[model samples]
Target: MDLLPSAHVDAYPREHLPPRDQWPVLSCDLPSLAYPDRLNCGAELLAGGAPDAPCLRMPGGEVWSYDDLRAAADRIAHVLVDDLGVVPGNRVLLRGPTTPWLVACWFAVMKAGAVAVTVLAAHRAQELATICGIAAVGHALCDIRSVDDLAKAEVPGLRIATYGGEASDDLLRSAAAKPDRFEAVATSADDVALIAFTSGTTGRPKGCMHFHRDVLAIADTFSAHVLRPRADDVFAGSPPLGFTFGLGGLVVFPLRAGASTLLLEQAGPEQLARAVAAHRVSVLFTAPTAYRSMLQLPGGHDLSSLRRCVSAGENLPAATWRAWHEATGLRIINGIGATEMLHIFISAADDAIRPGTTGVAVPGYEARVVDPLTITELPDGEPGLLAVRGPTGCRYLADDRQRDYVRDGWNLTGDTYVREPDGYFRYVARADDMIISAGYNIAGPEVEEALLRHPDVREAAVIGVPDESRGQVVRAFVVLRDGLPQDGRTGTAEALRAFVKEEIAGYKCPREIRFLPGLPRTPTGKLQRFRLRDLE
Candidate 1:
């Protein structure tokens, strides 16, 4: 097809449920599948491909080539197996943003035949301890700065792995110095590869166990139909590598497509824009909040290099899409994926996209709105709970909610959506996260997306709070941009509220805007609505 250099990265080398050929199908379902299920991952990169392509380009233009990445992975692989006493099926708790070291640690874990449980770098010790306890993580690969906090966490007998900057890591260097030749351990398709934790605005957290097949499944679904990538392209983004969103962006998607990845250690909308301008990153994966942030930045950031953008972790409203197109002539491909689904299960090409709708189901998955209680699919164009399923499935580790989630073969993501007559899926709200005030059923995200449309608002989080008078009232926690309007008395806050009322239904508008420095967020780019509720 003669695509761009960075766009040629591999996806699912082979599609399973749909049975694809061009895609590389990785399966641990064999005698040859390596233990720790290593071969099922970037170990293939060891077999020779894109050797000189940039794997990771950081602040100093310190880019690591695919060859360098593989060698580094090999060293870490040896350390994992020979030093840390890691074996097949053990989970390695990894916490960090996307960087060459993070990438190396990921492949090295898988290369050593171990499953990687990615903990959002933003997770506090309590969250970390909870994940380790749930996933049975015995070893941790953490950033040096955060190792002390992690050490204090309740991961009994937890082995520690530390790295120094990008190149100055003795721990990783010792591992990376090993012979660049090591065979991947045998593993299987159904074997868990990652325990991704996601929170419902209310609960503690649930660990979504994804199989090796699920790793390729997301690409099988989204690549051909949505944000397709090619070799020679460089994938980079603000979503932390710990989240599946970033895992797919900085590693899986690019590796699956035979492309390199650029990992940003410190990522925010501003930092991402500067990095994008400097690196000419081709495919960008982030949230709508970051997109809006980039638009407010001064013009001429040289974003001419961006070709494809994918938005998830939150609903992508119409205004954000327009703002992106106006800024870069690129439409942000909006996708809605749950940690349970591994990655974006519903998405569409920007050209084929419908602005507010999350888009149609991916190539290998089925999406339908259903009555949550009845467990039956709803008629077309009807709004109901969104239940989905695919060949690559989700199994919660030791959670009783498993029965509640997967009913009669359908993975009921706790979300409500309306399926358009034309097969598109529109975001409604999380079934349990919906806010009911008096007679109005308010979707927090709907109101939040509306608030983000305002120029002065940097980010907004909407949550319903208890109110005896009108039932539950919608409250918004807003972070103003660099140059917010002055006049606290009746100016900035009042203007934002007015703007929200104009953008959305008056009933759905936030009753009050509480200016804050920043909205609470998880590492993967999901705004923590739970925190918004706590602010009350």
Candidate 2:
């Protein structure tokens, strides 16, 4: 087997990768996990599948066969190489909604042997700038709808190409001049394929580096063993392609099984149900909050075509699960996954599911509950930190916080959980200040920082408050500058919310703003988040 042509030795992704000693030990016991040393995941995922089979069903009733997707991806790969001067291992930042073109761009990056750095479509310029800077992204493919944010990011020397834009900016136009067939680069199994930057407890996000092998590993492990799909199945989901959860559910899992996926730009509760009905989708993946919201929708959405529904990104409340089951006669398959590990590590399908518990670890993965302080294994039924290790595990890119996440050999998923005697994992709470609201990870300090940017706010502290619909909502406690009108409470709160929305993603803005005389702090001056939760 011939090795892929090497990129510059000074590639930032390779240069900034964590030292060998810090990487979590990878394991693959499944027969499907046996992959070739010279593997191109894009070739495996896009080119070598059933080319004539239906692969992507667009929102407008247009269908694309596997061959169609492959041809587009190959052309895009050529565009990257010839038009954009992209070399193997160059970091290509992708910014767009989850559409067929975006999916095609992702596969194209993989086929070109470039590392894909995908950020959520909802991210503002500041977030985009921080991520691009951290990942050292030099080239970008962005949707025209999102090009404004990319331009606002002002990344240095970033070569920008547009897709879903005007004729002059369209990537497809560039690719039209190129051949529609391309041979994917044969890269080593351990080569970094993509960088998924997940939000941290602090204000910054940490990039989790995954390999070509890890790309196939998640599909072989969780998707293969747990959420098994047939070639006839059509998958659809809400999470953005930037999130690993969305990437796995929409792209990897379906494509791995030679199935098709329906890409939806907006997959809220009502829209999701409509998509299921309109597309006759067979497999559904979304967060728990979406399930709860859909359960409240007026009953005209035909969901009889859906055989499976997957819930993740946050805990599935037993009540919400039962409600969804009673409404649809389908038990939502609950799972727990992290950006670091790439996809779901624990999940149960159909009859094997227990209402409140995240079922046993998926085949090819191992998990345990450990004492948060000592890092020692804890007995079942005792709440402690959840540690997981498998073919995919934590690999932070040049972040010192890697030491806190990976201990010994286990990836401590900053989550508190209790394992039942039957091997079921029950979610307790988050071990850190990071808040999971409506399936998006919102750092409290990040919200506080946004709020503080407002002139009217003297001091601000943000925390997650329990909510039935959103799972949690961001609530801010603020000490306001003295001159504000007390009678204008409604106006003031809305003003602060709008102000924060300008600085950050609208989803992270405070849903409720309460002006307080002072925020609760410890004697040592540490913000007492627990105390704020009690007030809620």
Candidate 3:
């Protein structure tokens, strides 16, 4: 891969990209993915809609026109360069719930030619600090309600700016004084636009660097060809913009199609149903858990407005798919995407879908089930590792784990799958110790690390257990220190759960904890996690 001339003044992101030879095979066979050398995705996405067309809508009946969003993004871009001293390639951290203003901030970062590092609002101080440290973040744009956690992160010399607040120094207040028109930076298509972080089974997060062109490649391949979104569609979802699944469904896909989206800050099963009916949302993106829960809602919901439903972040069971189609005449599109690949690569929609399979590779992508050791393609009906390559592939930020993810021009997603004779990829199991509970990825070792921080815990092991609601739930087996009260086990379990919550995100906390005299270990002193699963 040849390099393109960059417009970035600060070159940290580019300097940290993995060696070009280690990158997965990238393809752009589709006509829509042939982007120009000097492209700004922020300006491109805002180009199609009419000036007065609705671009963003809130649950409270507030709507922002295309012109309104463009102007706000332009003003914020000016504020980034002039007020915050931001230059191209500087990593700017964005921490906020899903809202119109958060989307505007993302566009502003792109327009200013800076790399956006979007972390979830549920991330705590330790998680935020780890991400900021890895990305070398110097500035943060945080919502007023979510500023406290970012403020507690130990990133020295970090410049923090708050938004959606009445403070005099708020980001929106500063933008109010700036002009509503600014020229977007003429960045190369290969310039880093965002660095999304994903947890590894090793209990550390890896930064996935995606180029400016990768953002639009997802829309061209999956959204354009498969989802077939129309300009009149109204998108709504429960994913926060920090996750790529949410970012594409809520922001990129709709904006690229010149459609409108309803942003919800707190979307539970009931809240999602009400908003869909009230706003007439036609397209929805959420996990299978949400769909299952919505089906059990009291008196049911008026989902007649919905035409398309997308399920990702975790596997969609055949039972859930059948139940949803039986209730509402809409077929749920199931996709499997990684933070490294940016968005979905293998998915099916409409008549092409199979109940239990994850469909064939989307247009412009290739997938195969390969033997993990030799990378040889496996025969039909044989379970092996799932490997894929496409226009957008894994590019870790200078991590040695790059070799583990990308091998022989293919990205090996740590999933075990079996390919049917007809080419449909069937769902199997994860080959790693990652726990997918209610659409969130929880690393077992990471949760175990949090549990070990307690003085009472002598040893601990975490594993994912099957659940009816969530696909899987985190369960922990702990060996306490000497002389602990054995009769008060129930109270100790509650106390341990509360202790773990303070150290990490509440969602990663173990739902069930069982006391053990000793964790299963080998003679070589290595923990045997397979024994833990057997105990479950």
Candidate 4:
């Protein structure tokens, strides 16, 4: 209940932490939720575990044990401190596919007492620059294939190092010469551990600052109480590690439970099913869209190994849940979570799962439905904004938007929901411009800003339109700059889309672009996204 003093003196992350008053009130009432003031999550996750305990299993049949992971992380941490001159509380950016090495790099940053800034591998040069600049990242451990984009980000004085490459300059090679064992930094529970970015409606990324304790809290609460994963459970999912959903489901939860994760660098529906069958994955974490697609997979795919399936990212439709149960006789565990909160805070496991609703709050957390305008608690069955306060809550780093996310000790998750008398929360529509497609959160303004970068586009408005397969796809209504030939309409649209893909991540690019004479706007020029949705 009290703040813990950090051990690191540099504390660059502490300097940028939002003012104390703006922080969401964190509560840990459950006995299982207890955490120490002086803690290092990496040490807790990897140290003192059985040497032969399986920690990670790659799709290629390669497996790493708890001891192996710790040794690898220790080597990388030595490289960070001795070779890269990294100090405690420094922000280290990680950009790579979801591989065992990337997970090692993640723990390595925390082991060295540095804050991990995980960036999605799909991000382009511009998006990477914005994130690095906002976090003031000074060092990056990047995948060799991503070197070009990292260079294009153009952050001054940014020390670049390579990982997962066979080159002599790769982090793996440099780390091999280091000792096998190193002491994990003694970071306080309240010290910043990682900065995960979520897209803002205003076209900027908001870095959600999480503490070292918050990481373990989710594992103890959600993964422990809800999913109830055992040490032998093998976790696998489609979400990129950059997203908290994947970081928790694929890495933190498994590591905390002493379970192994079958890392799928590029897991689509087919790949997911195959991975599950091949690796005998016990727990599956993926979005509802993937669930539907996996159901459509041709016969003879043995998913019998899957005992528990968790769906999040986008709202889980009751139909998808029923379909999964019908196909596999295994109920899908549906939960809702945000990057700010780390992972699923409200989820039901096994028989507690109620179809069509995001189940009761996981132990150690509290949730309520509140009127969006007044922030007053709404009666059961009345849909309004969802507010939650628990061990893990929103803590935006040095951003004034912290005031918008956390108010009156509660984090206002920008989601419309209804709480039933039975305490099950049902999802409604999002209260913002965020579009959850497949499993990625794409902000409409961020995409519009990317489209605006094109020379031929004067104005652009991006909105999420319903799609059967992807949940929601980015659709753009563009106002082409005048004086264009009438026959160039098709070419211009395609060109604008390509230009946007070049500017931002490909997934954020508008899948379908329509030329509009003018966009619907108020007298003050405020965009009416409702009208755009109506056009769909």
- Candidate 1, overall lDDT? 0.73
In angstroms, what RMSD does candidate 4 have relative to the true structure? 10.7
**Every model's TM-score:** 0.87, 0.81, 0.83, 0.82
lDDT of 4 by residue, 131-175 (tens): 998898999998887778989989988999997778897899998
**Candidate order (TM-score):** 1, 3, 4, 2
Worst 10 residues of 4 by lDDT: 519-528
Model 3: how far is 509 from its true place, Å?
27
lDDT of each: 0.73, 0.83, 0.88, 0.84
lDDT tens readout by residue for model 1, 70-144:
888888888887877887767788776566777788888777767788776567777778777777678888767
TM-score of 2: 0.81
Give the better candidate number (1 or 2) by lDDT.
2
Show pairs that collide, candidate 3.
none
> In model 1, which range of ten residues has the least summed lDDT?
7-16
On TM-score, the candidate that comes out on top is 1
Where does candidate 2 stray beyond 4 Å?
Answer: 1-10, 433-536
Count residue pairs with overlapping backbones in model 4. 0
